[model samples]
Target: MVETDKPKQHRSRVLEGMAHAVSQKGYGDTTIADIVREASVSRRTFYEHFSSKAECLVALYEAASHNSLKVLRDAIDPAHEWQTQVERALAAYLGSMQANPVLVRTLFIEILHLGPEGLAARRRVNSVVADFILSMVNGSKGPKSHVLSSGMATAIVGGINELVLEYIEQDKVKYLDELVQPASDLVHAITRT
Candidate 1:
């Protein structure tokens, strides 16, 4: 049992190191050597953790989602208007991305090439955001209270994700406040209690 657990722990460490390296060097440029070096582990150790770079990326996506979800949860306020809630969530996400631009680029753009795992991670984040929005519209009762389609919720979150990416990549926020109103409006317009 101990030996089995060791591999799992090492895998997490390797994934974390890869995320850090990719954040700095980008996924395309990052190599296995860089990941193992970042983890301070030997080549054999890395192989024990993952079969290849793609597997490492799968783990990285999970890590990034966990971090992003924490930030989003903190931004939520039960007392705030649904509009304000959306704004706060967007602000929180964008702020996090701005603070960790390299990580954002790796998770959002680079790691996508890793196939199913990467795509699933992205979808998981989107679902989280949709659920958050649904909560605001439905209150504690959940989807039963809000009549919005799942498709609409997905679209709104996707748009928000794209917008956040643009804001991060361009290194400019010409009118940051505008993002809030539109984001809130989009959610409010679609959601009916």
Candidate 2:
């Protein structure tokens, strides 16, 4: 393998290892040793990517969240009806989360164990999601006077996250798709006002 690609590959493996260990043993019980073992990389290599388990988990949280957001982003079609776009995007986002039950639990539930650091990582991702919602709502084919403010967008993201957290907590991650319609309704309801 190329030298540059090797580091990235190791980092990715470590991240996956963290996710795997967290999913199996929960973040509280998982150790750096477990991560390296699952990742098939050396402890030195793990440190090269992450300083501690919390950092590794946070990175995994961010990576998984970004991937889900990408699904939401790609599902949007500006040319379609605004309501349709919202529904599709919501469905796609939930579908992406449902696709990986392990991440659904580890990223949504376990990350919070990191306290402030976890919250900050979650806030950063939520802000990006809010921005995406802003673009979709403001750029939609709706009333000229109707504008979805950043605060409301943030609130919507939080609400959706709460719904996801509930599902993960209940071990119903596979049923996350059930939230799409209600979540989409919320965006429509708020944006219309």
lDDT of 1 by residue, 1-193 (tens): 6887877778778877897888778787889999999887888999876788887787777677678778877887765655446667877766676666556667668768766877877787778777765555656433344466668878888877677667656754444445666666666666642
Kindly list the per-residue Cα lDDT of model 2 for residues 71-143, writing each as its tens digit.
9878877667666577778888899889888788877779889999998998898899999888877876756
* Model 1: per-residue Cα lDDT at residue 12: 72
The TM-score values for the models, in the order shown, are: 0.75, 0.94
lDDT assessment of candidate 2: 0.86
Clashing pairs in 2: none
Report the error of model 2 at residue 130, Å. Answer: 0.6
Off by more than 4 A, model 1: 1-12, 79-81, 140-146, 171-182
Model 2 stretches astray by more than 4 angstroms: 141-145
- The TM-score obtained by model 2 is 0.94
